[model samples]
Target: AAVPWPEVYGAGGDSPGGAGRPTRGAGALVVVQDGRLLAHLTRGGRSVLLFSRPTMGDEDGPGATDPADVQAVVTVLSSLISVGRLSPVTVEKVNGTEVMSLGAGTRAWTEAGARFTPKGLVVR
Candidate 1:
């Protein structure tokens, strides 16, 4: 099923200077599986895949915890980033915590426990 981008990140307005203008931000591609975040892919920036089990109420079921599922999500996101399908996302500090603005009224905090690996970043 193709999840609509606007459903994940609220509808965004046009960039200043019309449709051809590019917005500024650390562009990224967020991947989710079974209602749980699987990975966050940033071009030329930090990228991370989930390695720990999601907390209660964070996922629809248990499938997202599987290694195969994680790998699949990472592979898809990596391909998208490499193909230049990444979207602009804003990063800012709020109350000493780094927050990533996904779109209008949508924001996520920076994961603090992520570690770099040969493949990319893994967040526990």
Candidate 2:
């Protein structure tokens, strides 16, 4: 399957302007699909990843929303930052809590409360 770039770079494949803007060539791609959260850090076309469980049929349970699933997502997201794939800077909002844009125009405080629809990770 192909990576969903539209969802990754927001609706129009453009990163919103700010410190959150992903570095042009080397960036992290985080995807929520098939009941799993797939995060990869790419540099110079090479990619490395961290995923939440396996999205393989009935072998694995449902989507990436359970407490365990959410935790896995958080871990991988933090890894992105720790690895320098993402910047630590972000706009503070929601009671002074900081929100960072995780490439593809998606903003997340943490992976804790993420919910995905058929279209992709719900942003709002």
lDDT of 1 at 88: 26
Report the C-alpha displacement of residue 55, candidate 2, in angstroms.
17
C-alpha positional error of residue 42 in candidate 2 after TM-score superposition, expressed in Å: 14
Question: Across residues 1-124, which tens digit of lDDT does each residue of candidate 2 receive?
Answer: 4543222212132223311222335254554656554443344212223233323443232121133544555555556657886543222211111123233212232345444343333222
Model 1 agreement with the true structure over 8-60: per-residue lDDT tens digits:
11112221111121123455455666776554444433433233343244432
**TM-scores for the candidates:** 0.31, 0.27
**What lDDT does the true structure give each of the candidates?**
0.34, 0.34
Relative to the true structure, candidate 2 has a C-alpha RMSD (angstroms) of 12.2
Q: When superposed on Cα atoms, how far off is each prediction in RMSD?
A: 11.8, 12.2
